[model samples]
Every structure is written in structure tokens, then in C-alpha cells.
Target: MAYKMPTQKYSGKILEVTVGSDLKLGGESVLPFYGFDGNIGNKPAIGMEIWDIFPESWPAAVLDVFKDAADDPLKWAAYCVEKYKPDFICIKFEGASPDGLNRSVEECAEIAKKLADNLTVPLVIAGCQDNDKNAKLFTKIAEALTNKNYAFLSAIEANYKEVAAAVGLAYGNIVVAESSVDLNLAKQLNILITQLGVKPDKMLMNPGCAAVGYGFEYVITTLDRIKLAALEQNDETLQMPIISPVSFEAWKVKESVVTQEDIPEWGPQEERGVAMEISSAVGVLAAGANAVILRHPRSVEVIRNFITEMTE
Candidate 1:
């Protein structure tokens, strides 16, 4: 007699989204659901991070790559496109923050336009850490790039509901929600956004990722719970596509920055940085991540290959 395997039936619903002119999310069942058992519908997309101003405080390893284009957002974006062939460009308007250089909204908009013109892929515009400032800046960029379809405008938090509402009304691609590490809070934020008229299909969740040896386990656990809830069809908030900020986690860890002399046993800083990124991204993929923002081109390639294998 031959042994037979039982087929697993996934209860969760997958959201389908067409970004810009070419990108599409194919609908399928299963968590972290690539196109394996069933049709995943969309291939995971990668976004290279580009800051509005020169990152003088960045780790030496990161600084070394962007040394030439750090001061110019357009040139930097073009470099990422030419070198990495990223699926999308994620531009962070750090210069517009109050604590930072405080570049004006108009200036930020100008930078966004230049990048949009230079790149053929879709764009995701993120404001600085300040909610109020980000709201104003994000709105300006959304309006400026209206000609480009499928641009993801973010970070609609609890304090910036009004701005989020405006972006929703504009019908531009938008990312709304929070990183509470709590399932209820995540759902509540999504509910709030929907109440304001934002469609569920257009929203993306960022539960946030902590570095390895940090609170990574907790982050993974939270994401796992969210994914389980979504798969069980018990929570609609967790159903939307998820975006993991992998680069942010990689850059913040001391292991990724400290020199060999400072942390001799930790090994090379460059290797550490890459390891941090790959580990963080792989962990999130297990939990449930449809998109990821990364800094290094090598990590992106490794992750892409890993995802391809999983789906195969």
C-alpha cells in the first residue's frame, strides 16, 4: 500500500493589488503564502531605501556604498535602479523632520518628483518620524506624483488620521497602521483607517522588526499571531499585505556598525550587516511578509532567491 499526504486547506483570503503599470499581487491561500501549494498571485517586491539628505550618522559600512550619491536623492535612486534593479523605490523624507535638517515640504516634493521621473518602478514616500510633519510632507508628494500610478504613501498613524484620510480620499496607494506588537492595537488602527474610508486592499501593515539578539523573537511571535489570526479568518485587520522594514532593523544594531577593534569576536562589520539583514528578512518571511525594504543589494538578491525556492 502507498502512503498518501493530506491536503491542507488554508482559510485566509489573499488581497490582490496591481502596482504602478507592471506589478501585481496574485491572490492565493496560505500564510507568507508564496505561489507554492496554491497560486500566490504576486511575487514579493523589494524596495531600496533612499534618504532625502546625506546620512552623516549612518554606520561606516552603509556610508561607504552611497558616498558618491548621498547628497543627491535623484542620483542615489538611479544608482539603486541601475545597480540593484529594485522592484520599487522607498524614499524617506528625513530632512523634513523637526529634529533633523527640517527641509520644507516643497523641497521634499521636488526631490520625490526627480526620483519618480528617473525610475520606472512604483514609489513609496515615507515622512520623517514626526507625524504632523510627515502628514504635510506625504500629502505634498502624493499630489506632486499624481501622474504616476500605484505610489504607496505612508505612515498614517493614530495621531495623523486626518492626513491619512486625505490620502485615502485622493485614491493614491496608501499604507496605514501601526507596530504595537499587540494584535488588538493593530486591528484597531486598521478599523480606524477603514472608518475614514480607506479601502482594505490598499492598506499595508508594518508590525515592525527588531534585530537579531534583540527582541527579534517577540517581533516574530507577534507577526506569527497576526498571521495565524488572518489564516483562521478571525481577523480582517491582519489580512492585508505586510511590509517589513528590514533595513531599519539592520542599521540600528550595534553588531552591524561597531568596528572589528570594538567588537573583535563579532567578525567583520560588513558581513555582520549583511547577516543581520538576511536573518531579519528570513524571520519575517516565516511570520508573514509580502514586501520588504532593504539597504544592501546583496541581501536583496539572497532574499529573492530564498523566496523563489520556498515558492518552488
Candidate 2:
């Protein structure tokens, strides 16, 4: 007799959110990659992270991959789209942060509008890490490019009211409800965002993730808990798709940054950075990320292939 894999049925489905014209995420009625057990509507979408103003902190090895267009955001984004062909483009408005260059809302919005207007793929607009800055910037950008079906990287508990109201509800775009890696906090944040009229289908959850070996277990456990609740308990509030900004968290770790001279045992710098990104991205995809945003074209290519081999 042949051995058989056990199958399980889930009661609830993860609501699907569309980006650009056709990229779909979530709608899986089972845990990540359990296709034999239940319906998995779409393969996780992979987005490339482009910056409004490029950061100088990137590794030289990885930088070499994008050297031709690294200095200019528009060129960089177009280059990535033309070359890598990512599912979507995630624009990091780092210059607009209050602590950073403190770029004006209009300046950032103009750049954002230009990118949105030119990019053919769906755009994910991530504001600087400041709540106030993100609120103003998101609102400005949303107003400038309405109905293009863009997504925001986050609306935290602190500014859910402003973001959910202004961008999610008013502009009719998707909002990511971000919370620390805790089940209840994630659920509560989702509930709050939904209460503001941003329906589940128009929302994605960011239950927080970290690079591999850098508090990554918390990411997995949190994702598992959320998926269980959404599938087994049929928790509507927790049923939105999950989008992990893997690049933002992964590239900053020491493993990706230290030079081989600085740490000979760590091996090559660019290869290490790409490894870190791929590990973080694939780890989250297996754990539960419905979509992941990545840096480093090599990392994106590897994970894109992995997703195809598994999900397709």
C-alpha cells in the first residue's frame, strides 16, 4: 500500500487583495504551501524595493548589481522593472522621514506621483519610519494617484485612524495593519482597521518579521498563531493576507553588512547579503507571508524561482 499525506479542511479563507492590474495575494484556505489539503488561490507575490532617494548603506557587492541606476530612483526602478520583472514595485520614501532629510510632503509626493505614473506594476508605498511623516506622506501620495490600486506598507496602531481613514477608506486602496509579533496585538489592530471601514479584502496584515537568526522564531510563531486562528477558529479579523517587508528588516543585520575583511569566516559580502535576504524571504513565505518585498536582484530571482517551483 502507498503512504498518503494527510489532508485538512479549513473553515475560513484569507481574503484576496489585488495589486496593479492582476497580481493577487491571499485567498488561501490552508496554511502556507499546503496545496494538497485545500485551496491556495495564488502564489505569493514578490516585489522589489525601490527608494525615492537611494540609501548609501547598501553593500558594495549588492550595489554593483544596480550601480548603473542606483543614484536615481526613477532610473533604478525602471531598471529593476525592465531587468528583474518583479511582481510589484515597493517605493521606500526614506528621505521624507522627520529625522532623515526631512523632505517636504510636496517634494516626496511629486516623486511618488512620477513613479506611480510610470511604473506598470502595482506600487507599494512605504513611508519613512515616522508615524506623522507616513500619515502626511501617504495621504498626499494617495490623493495624487487615486484608483491605481496601490498598497501601503503600513498603518500602525498609532496612526491607523489617519491612514485607514485617509488612504484606505477614502482613496480605496489597501492598507497593511502592522503589529509587533503577537497574536492578540495583530488581531486587535486588524479589528481596529476594519472598524474604520477598510474591509478585509482591502487589508493585509504585517505581523512583524525579522531576518533569520535575528529574532526570526518570533516571526514564525506569530504567523503560525495567526494562520491557525484565521483557519481553524475562522477569525475574520485575522483573515487578511500577510505582507512581509523582508528586505527592510533583513539587509540591516550584521550578517549582510560586515565586510569579508571585517569577518573572514562570514565569507563574501554581497553573497552573504543575498543569502540573508533569501533566507529571510523564504523563511517568511514558508511560515505564512502571502507576499514579500525584497532587495538585491539575485535574492529576488532566487526566491521567485523557489515560489514557482513550490506554488506553481
Candidate 3:
């Protein structure tokens, strides 16, 4: 069978960032660089999320996956690493922030240290939603893990440059800069982080994620524009890699969490959750995301396999 393929051409190369001392988050050129005729130097890495506190509000399907280790962050992280074999672990300091559980900074650092020592793969430590609280949390962890060189700091937002600067000073390899859906805002935050002496290769930008049927189009457009600009050698903005919290979007969707009783004929909740993760991931890859923070070991396995097939 003969078919016509689009002969589109792209410019510039995807930037690569090595996470741990031995791990390489390699550069990839071409959207969803897994397909034939594209260039993908590194396999897209998977990161599983571990929270300090068990999320009681999570849907049954998700809660079941973490049932045994929900209350224990270290155990959960180890379990995910052992089971899913993820490339890294993203330890979410959900309740340890001032606006949340308000745990002491020392305690947060201790938890991060535990994960760092227990897991061999790279680590990502994220603070609670509050900017002030996260800044304080990341600062402490950044200092504690300075010598480790395997941990990536959660974020440095427009309002949190002080914390980001502290992290950069401590030699953290990666820091996430988040902005609303605005591309300019995303670029501006990246610039702010770089101004703090952090190199372009060490920064990751997340424009925030929206669930399917809930502003997903806007998220896609934002990511597409950002990638397009980067391909054109928009040096200031295209120099860093892009990350997306794909699981966050899927877990929050009603179809992913609601029971059949709440919405009959929705099929199995677990299957729906997996589907949501896959759809969001595929879309984000098309938009030029280099990495993703995901949950559910099953979904990670599926997505990794899919990426492998595409790259082959």
C-alpha cells in the first residue's frame, strides 16, 4: 500500500538535560520524536509521585494502587521504584507546607533525605501549593541535598525567585518554573530563574496542565506555541526542556475518578484512569514535552511501552 506523508521540516534541536550523575535526559528533535524519521536521543523517562500524606479524596482506583504505602512516603517511593521501575521519583511535599499540614522545614528535609538515600534513581522534591511555603521548603532540601547531585527542585515561580536562587546556589541540577497558560509568562519565569545564575540547561518549564474536556485545548495551544518558538531558535525560551504533570490532569478529571453509579456505563474506573493518562500523555508529547510526572505503575508501564514502540 502506498501512502502520502507530510514533508514538513523543522529547525533547531531539542535541548538535553542530564538529571543524576549517570542519567541522561537526552535531547530529541521533531514533535513526539518517537516516530520514524524523527530523532529521539533519550527515552522519555517516567516519574512516579509520592506524597507525605495519604490523599483520602483520591478515587478508589487510585487509592487502591497505593493502598499499602499510602501513609508512608519512603515505602511508597520504594514500592513504585521496585514495581514500576520508573526513571525517577517525584516526592510531593503535599502537607508539609505552611499553608497545608505546616510541617517543620527540618522534617521536610528529613523526608527528602530518606527518599534520596533509599532510591538510586534521581529525585524531584516539590512543595505544597503556597509559594512562600514552597520557597522555604525547597531551600532547605536544596541545601541538604547539595552534595547528592541527584535531586531536582520542584519549582521557582515568578513570586518565588528567592527560593529558586537559593536552589541554584546550592547546585541543584533542575528547577521547575511554572506560569499560567500564558507563553510569555512561562518564558518570563524561565528568564527570572536564569538571571539568578541558574543555567538554561538546568531549568524546566511547566505551563500548567488542564484535563480533557476542561481547557485541554488551551493547554495544547500553549505548549505547541512554546515548542514552535523553540524550534525557531527562540534561544531565550527554547533553551530548556518542558515538563508536564500528566497524572495530575488525569486524576482530577471526573471520568477518571467517578464510580459507575455516579456516571453509569462509564466502564471500569481503573481502565478509565489509564485511558485518561494515555490521552493526556500523547497530547503533551505532540506539544513537545520532554518529561512527565505520572502516577499508577500500570499507566507508566503502558506509556513506556508505547514510547518504545514509537521510537522503534
Candidate 4:
């Protein structure tokens, strides 16, 4: 008898989302890129990370690469797009944080608008987690990018009303609903955002990604459950695409932050950092990540290669 392949059926599918000029993400009928079983609407997309201001706390590994471009947000983003050719660009409004530069909302809005005007690719804006500050920043940024519908406004949790309302007022752009590692919390957040008048398809879930060595297993397991719920139990509330903010979590760990001199056993600082980001990203992709936001151009290249190999 001829050999046969077995595949499981799924009733749920990921929502397809478009950003920037023509960047499409999600819409998968199977987990990740299991094309043998179902349709892979679009290959997982990667967005290289940039910041509104120079990241002074970044180690030499990351700092060295963007030293020149760091001084100017526009220039830095342009460099990432032109040089790295990422599927999209993600700007972390770290400067708006209370402990950071404490940049005014107006200033942050101006920077976001400038980047939106310049970058032809899709943009993802992640503001600091301060409820009041982030809500204000998100409102301004959402308004600024309303026309293009090119930006993804991050993290409508704990402040779902304020941020989701901002996106609603803007009339365009996607919202990222975030939750802790808990699956129920993740689902509840989605429901809450949907109730606020944001369509479920227009939202993406950030299910609390942690780095490789930092509770990574918990993240993997949580994501698997979420995917299973969506596919097996036909959970409409959980069918949205999943986006992992890989860099921020990865860089905070000891393995990624420590210097070679500080930890001799660890390899070169640059290579170690890239490995951390890459490992975390790959793990998430395997567990069912539809989009990954990353720092470190090298890590981006590596993950892109992995995605191509797996999908092809």
C-alpha cells in the first residue's frame, strides 16, 4: 500500500491583517506553517526594532551597530529599513517612560508621525506601560497615523479602555491586546477589547513572551494552549494573530546582558545576545507566533532564514 500522511482538522483560523503599504500577516488555517494540514495565509513577518531616542542602557553589542543612527530616530529607522530590509519596523517609545527621557507627549507624537511619513513599510508602536502616560502617547500616536492605517498600537491591557478608545477614535490601525502568561487572562483581554468596539480581527495578542532562559517554557506552554483552544475548541475570541516582542524580554536576561569579561564562560557578547534573541524567537515561532518584533539585525536575519526554510 502507498504511504499516507495524517493531518488534524481545525475549525478556527487566524485573522488576516495588513499594515504599511502592503505587508500582510496571519490568516493561517493551521498552527504556524503546517501547510500539509491547512493553508498558511502568510509567512510569519519580522519587524526590526528601533527607538525614538538613543538607547543608552544597551550594551556595547547593540549600541555599536546603531551608534550613528541612534542620535536621530528618523535616520535610525531609515537605516534599519534600507540596510536590514525587515518586513516592518517597530518603534519602542522608551523615551516616554517616566524614568527615561520623560519626553512630552507632543514630542513623541511628532517623532511617530515623522517615521510614519518616511517609512514605506508597516510600523508597530510600543509605548511604555505607564497607564496614564501610555494612554496619552497611544492616543496621540494613533491620531498621527490614522490616515495610513500603517501602525499597530500596542498593549491594550490594564488600560484597555483608554488605548482601545484611542484606536477607535483614530478609525484605523490595529491594536495589540496583551496579557500575562495566563491563557484565561489572554482570552478575557481579547473579549474586553472587542467589547470596547474594536473588531476581534483587528486585534493581535501579545501573550506575555519571556526570554529563552527566563520562564521561556511557561510561554511556550501557554501559547500552545492558546493555539489549541483556537483550533480545537473553536474559540472565536482567541483566533487573532499572535505577536511576540522578542527583543525587550531577551535583552533583559543575564545571559544576554552580561559582558564576556563579567562571565567568561559565556561566548562573545555580540554572539550571545544574538543567540538569546534568535532562540527566543524560534521557540515562539514553533509554538505558534504569527509575527515577531525583534532587535539586533543579525537576529532578524537568522529568524527570517529560519522562517523561509520552515515555510518553504
Query: How far in Å is the alpha carbon of 58 misplaced in model 1?
Result: 1.8
- Local accuracy by lDDT, each model: 0.75, 0.88, 0.75, 0.85
lDDT per residue as tens, model 3, 29-80: 6565635546766777778877888877677778888778888988898888
Query: In candidate 2, residue 276 scores what lDDT?
Result: 88
Runs in model 4 deviating more than 4 A are: 151-153
Clash count for each candidate, listed in order shown = 2, 0, 0, 0
Candidate 3, residue 82: the lDDT equals: 84
Of models 3 and 4, which has the larger TM-score? 4
lDDT of 4 by residue, 1-312 (tens): 998999888888777877666877788878877889989879999998888888887889898988799888899999998989998888999899998779988999899889888887878888875767998888888888785655554655667888887775455778888888989999999898888788776788898899987889999999999998998888999988889999989888888888999988888888888889999999999999988988898998899999999999
List residue ranges in candidate 2 displaced over 4 A: 1-5
- Provide C-alpha RMSD values for all models, in order: 2.0, 1.4, 2.7, 1.3
Q: Can you give the TM-score per candidate against the true fold?
A: 0.92, 0.97, 0.90, 0.96
Leading candidate by lDDT: 2
**Superposed Cα deviation of residue 105, candidate 3 (Å):** 1.6
User: Tens-digit lDDT track for model 2 on 100-136?
Assistant: 8999888987987888878888889999879988998
